[model samples]
Target: MTFPAFVDLLRQLYVNVAEHEFALPDKQQTDSRVSLLTGVHRKEVSRLRGAGAPVRVVPDSVSRTSAIVARWLADPQFVDARGTPLPLARTSEAGEPSFAGLVESVTRDLRPRAVLDDWLDRKLVEIDDEDRIVLMEGAMVPRGDGEVRLYYFARNLGDHAAASVENVLADAPPFLERAVHYDGLSEELARSLEAYSREIAVETLLRLNKYANQAIQNDPGGSSRWNWGVYILTSDATSLVAEETPENKNAGGETA
Candidate 1:
């Protein structure tokens, strides 16, 4: 995260783009091409050339856990009429939407009992008075694990930044990035607006997550990845973070 590290990462990306997107049939000349395009030293480009693009490390179980959690939030079998997840009995024989049934619906390789134990340890779920498994709010997202949090931080921020860059550079299709920024607010008004913004934001995200969860059940896995994210900000600073303008034009995305 130091300047030098960032530079190195950018340099690597440039080389990857040049090699993969702008490759010459003459393989030995790739370093020179990358150097010309990125203004990196040819020697440095040569050293970095053909190094595979850096990939973020993801924990092995995140995808499966996320899928199960999403389904629990979405699938009617697991949620009540109001779309809230229901407390599940321990096994399928006990009733529908039991923890055992939910796990097997996602995957049979991992035992339901084992997953339940892990979730309990992680504080993602708890057994209530009736001894039914109940999901904690915001349990679908991995926040406590620092590594998982960092991976998501990079993915969300990186994609938003990329979209903004593409727009500034006028690269083909533009991405959707919009916000409403206002000033001259009293603390009370700002806090009220912030509260309203968060309520609407959480609702929007949960609705979309549910829709996506149901929609993807029949899907054969595809290469394209998709995400929708939102943020809300209310700052007490006397001045705008960037130079003031009539309209909100800075690229940072927000819901309010």
Candidate 2:
């Protein structure tokens, strides 16, 4: 029989147990119920049960339906006789999205530097691979002993397209220090950088969208731009002056 038919039979059995307030049928009775509900041979039910088909029983008549529903809900591998996982309602945490916990779990098991480097490499490829640009200067600045400051730059022939490339750089993860500095005035090179810049702008806008969505869910009037904050550090006695570049300016056009 078709998979859907098998599933229907299993569901009917569940409903029957729910309404009748009785234990699920024994093996022989189960086979008979399958044959009656799905028009499949009793032998088919026996075979499926041997192959790990889950059969649950209600222990108490007073709350039989609730008990059966709860059992089905708790079992991650609970499938119908046809072998489809039953859909269950999902509950999200107060401050976390559905996949946030999974992401954190995976990241926690990885080396921080390795993860950062790998993600940066992917972003670089998206920005430069097709345009034949070569990444020239790249470094992961050590922030004390455990943190890093990632920086990279690439160069290409003056005429490459700029849109998608720019987006990759701008939308890169927040840990990276990103900028596009012009090296020469050739028309082809300038066009490529322009494309890179535009793409980065697009990526930034997408990041803003994510931040805005989070803000709305967290606080009704929270500012989307407030989703991220900046920190500035300086040496106590150095004579160095940090000037903000027009292109690298954040929301306030100031150095951080």
Question: Which digits, one per residue and each the tens of the lDDT, describe model 2 over residues 19-77?
Answer: 22222555334556655554555676456544442223212221222222223322233
Candidate 1 residue-wise lDDT, 1-256, digit = tens: 5798767766765565555545667665566677897788999887776455432334556667887898898888999988889999998764666999999998988999999998998889999999999999848667677656645655566566656666777756477877866665678988998999888987888799888888887899876878788767888765655665656433243431
Clashes of each: 0, 12
Model 1 score (lDDT): 0.75
State how far residue 19 of model 2 sits from its true place (Å): 73
**How do all models score by TM-score?**
0.74, 0.19
Candidate no. 2 TM-score: 0.19
How many clashes in candidate 1?
0
Which candidate should be chosen as best, given lDDT against the real structure? 1
Each candidate's lDDT (Cα)?
Answer: 0.75, 0.35
User: Poorest 10 consecutive residues of model 2 by lDDT?
Assistant: 150-159
